[model samples]
Target: MAITKEEVLHVARLARLELNDAEVERFQGQLSAILEAVGKVAELDLSDVPPTSHPLEVSNAWGEDVPHTSLTQDEAFANAPERDDDHFRVPPA
Candidate 1:
């Protein structure tokens, strides 16, 4: 399918883009080529193909969940630039 200059202008206007005459002409050709390629893909016969979410078969690759000891309050706040009692202090937002 060919994309018209008017359609490109309309889309640019909807997107709040200010395209010059040259840009509009350039995008019209580029978009038309992209649409033509997509149309070619749509014309392919894929009746026997199954819809796949991924190109490769991927199973859960996560490691076993194991509980571990976390840093203590004092240890966690040791590198804080500013601290009050036991917590790190931050500048007012």
Candidate 2:
């Protein structure tokens, strides 16, 4: 379907845009072509197609989590800009 210049002007107004006559005419044609392309997509038959979030099949490649040695509290806070004996300090929210 063809889009009109008034429709383009109305959309420009809704978006708080200032379009001259030339821009309005240009957008009228461009938006009409876009609507026609989308209309063509709407005419397709896809009754057997399944909706998908991704176009390709996907699977997790990560291995199982393993336990490991961890840093002590003192080591963790060694580089703190402001810290108490047992914890880091921050400005009150």
Candidate 3:
């Protein structure tokens, strides 16, 4: 899992990044460490563990949907800067 300087340079080129020699060397070590850590994770024993979609239980907290009274058109449009017969108007973008 050791990342080489050439591989770092190639990755930077593919990503359209301009890195100096120091940055290339730095990223080489950092990327190599990340890959090594991931490799260690692959060595874990989880044969008996059941796969789960989520780590925690999930449920909706919303109340039941219900209809209610609403403001009239004039009341709703009272604060509008501009309006047509029954709708607000805005300039074209």
Candidate 4:
């Protein structure tokens, strides 16, 4: 569908934008052309085309997780900047 100047103005209003008469006319043409391009693309035969989010295969850099020995409480607390026996101490709230 062709986008009218009024439709452009309405969209501008919805977006809280201020457009002059010339700007509205320009946007009406630009947005209409975009719709026309999309419409043309929609007319293409693509029944065999598969839906894909990305053309390339994607994967996480980190590998599968495995159980491993973790640090003990003493080792974890050895490097604390501020600590109270078994817990971190912060400034008064």
Clashes of each: 0, 0, 0, 0
**Candidate 1 lDDT (Cα, whole model)?**
0.91
Against the true structure, what is each candidate's TM-score?
Answer: 0.49, 0.48, 0.47, 0.48
Query: How would the candidate models be sorted by lDDT, starting from the highest?
Result: 1, 3, 2, 4
**Candidate 2 Cα deviation (angstroms), residue 30:** 0.7
lDDT of 2 by residue, 1-93 (tens): 999888998999999999999999899999999999989966888687776678668767577799788999888888888888787987885
Clashing pairs in 2: none
Model 3's alpha-carbon lDDT is: 0.90
- Candidate 2 segments exceeding 4 Å error: 46-93
Alpha carbon lDDT at 13, candidate 3? 98
Stretches of candidate 3 off by over 4 Å are 45-93
- Model 1, residue pairs in steric clash: none
Cα lDDT tens digits for candidate 3, 11-93: 99999999999999899999999999988966989788787767777766577789789999999899998989899887875
Local accuracy of candidate 4 as per-residue lDDT tens digits, 1-93? 699888999999999999999999899889999999889967889889886777778866486689889988789888887889878777886
For each candidate, C-alpha RMSD in Å?
A: 8.5, 10.3, 9.5, 11.1
